[model samples]
Target: MQRDKAYVIKHYKKSLDWINNLRGLSEEQWRTPIAPGKWSVAEVIGHLPPWDMFVLNHRIPFLLTDERLPKGPDVAHLNTMAAKKSREQAMEETLNDFISTRRQLLQTIQQWTNEQWQHSFKIGQSEMTIIDYFVGLINHDLHHFSQIQNVIHV
Candidate 1:
């Protein structure tokens, strides 16, 4: 199997598992602040859309066709900018959008050829193999999920 695809698919399953586990949450719980000076659960979930759109659509194709990365829209500040919209959204809508968007992203990833798994990309000024990029995304999910869980029943 392609190494990057295998690793990313594995973790995407885990990400789905994590989201499924949250099926019991109350709306209030989903809206609870997940981190200090950071996103609420809904906002963090909302953040997935653009990243998935970027990676599965733009980055992979761009790297394969021209070997270039997105050069603008400071990613470090992205969550902050996006969280503003989340704050105005209904929790259920945001969660549904996250699940729907991620499912589409996983589907796109599954279509990639073996060479695409080795595609080089840059995320926030860091260089990475496609495998590393997917791993990092999985790790990012875990990190934020932990924050959500910590705030869930408290």
Candidate 2:
């Protein structure tokens, strides 16, 4: 089912607000792992932007056109690369990159015509609306956000 654009946008905004809560953490806090053998908070922050960039540059464009949706990159490889890059950057820099990329995505989405929001795109054998794509994005953000929160609380 197609979700209302306004409702999806509201949830997206709420997710951003939750991410903003990370602003006050110190550098060490940002780098702390949520659990052994898991990603650190900065790496979790690192993990997010590539997907937003993909949605902005690839998925959204494909949804607006007749182009086949591209297969996603290998998750483990992508996350490993992102984690390495995140560790190399200053915590604040990594955080800003994620926020900036996400904001750009929001701006792009806000400009979409109602029809664009309702457009269906194929992913492998399944299909989903543009709003469903946004829902997936929000779910992704929350997943990492929860990881950060859990690590910080430890």
Candidate 3:
């Protein structure tokens, strides 16, 4: 909630810890939908890695510079593919992907200078500080984490 680098890093690490500990979930539970017509738990978790990779590869490099940030991903298409893969793959694989990618993201965040964290940059028509950008992402993670918690009753 502080929206500082420390806070953002904490939640990112927390999310990884939460996912790593989910090995206890039954396969049926992993495959169960969070709600009717919504993504299954696995799908929800599976979608995270690509977004993390996007931040690592796309957003971070441009956020402190004047360069135009790359266009955001096609959400529907990416989620569709992620969901399909989640439904097809084992839960361990999905969780491992998340862990690996998220760890990379965390490492990158940890290396940022304070100015990099506080610097403002444009994304399309809008501008926000790098810390603010990460706060938004942390909120996104919280929303999905909450959805999964409700579905799995964990």
Candidate 4:
């Protein structure tokens, strides 16, 4: 699926607003699991900033270049750590972390040229455009957001 840079940027910006608004949720609600045997809303949101940082620090620099990309994060380990931190920290801390990292990501995205958006790059064995990469991330955000919404009705 083709994704416009503007659309992706919009989603990034909207995500900040969405998470910011979640400040109003009760502490219990913030900690509520999306489903049985699943992550709480805080865990889900907390996991996102590291991935954004990964994209900003690792993926973005190497994309559209001949350099071999660095290894991706260990997802399970990272998620586990983020979840543990989320469970231990205040809701405000989690929300602030999400907003800060997402804002950094959005700022980086705003500076990309059209060529950067559409040019194909090899990420490991898979080749895709910057837009394509972001579309996948956006879908991920949507999925987690839906889960959060379902549990909290916010």
Worst 10 residues of 2 by lDDT: 1-10
Off by over 4 Å in 4: none
User: What tens digits encode model 4's per-residue C-alpha lDDT throughout 1-154?
Assistant: 4479889998999999999889999988988899999999999998988888899899988886878889998999988988899889999999999999999999988999987899888877898888999999999999999999999998
Off-target runs (Cα >4 Å) in candidate 2 are none
lDDT of 4: 0.90
Name the better of 3 and 4 by TM-score: 3
Ranking by lDDT: 4, 3, 2, 1
Error of 3 at 104 (Å): 0.3
| C-alpha local distance difference test of each model | 0.73, 0.80, 0.90, 0.90
Candidate 1: deviation at residue 67, Å?
3.0
Candidate 1: misplaced stretches above 4 Å?
Answer: 1-3, 121-127
TM-score of every prediction relative to native: 0.80, 0.88, 0.97, 0.96
Candidate 4: the clashing residue pairs are none
The number of the candidate with the highest TM-score is: 3
141 in model 1: Cα distance from truth in Å? 1.2
Taking every candidate in turn, the Cα RMSD to the unseen true structure, in Å, is: 3.1, 2.3, 0.9, 1.2
Model 2 lDDT at residue 138 = 70
lDDT per residue for candidate 2 within 1-154, as digits (tens), equals 5467887777667667766777788888988887898888888888788878877887777887779988888888988888999989987788788779878888878898888888887888888888787777777776777777777863
Query: Which segments of model 3 are wrong by more than 4 Å?
Result: none
Q: Judge candidate 3 against the unseen true structure and give its global Cα lDDT, from 0 to 1.
A: 0.90
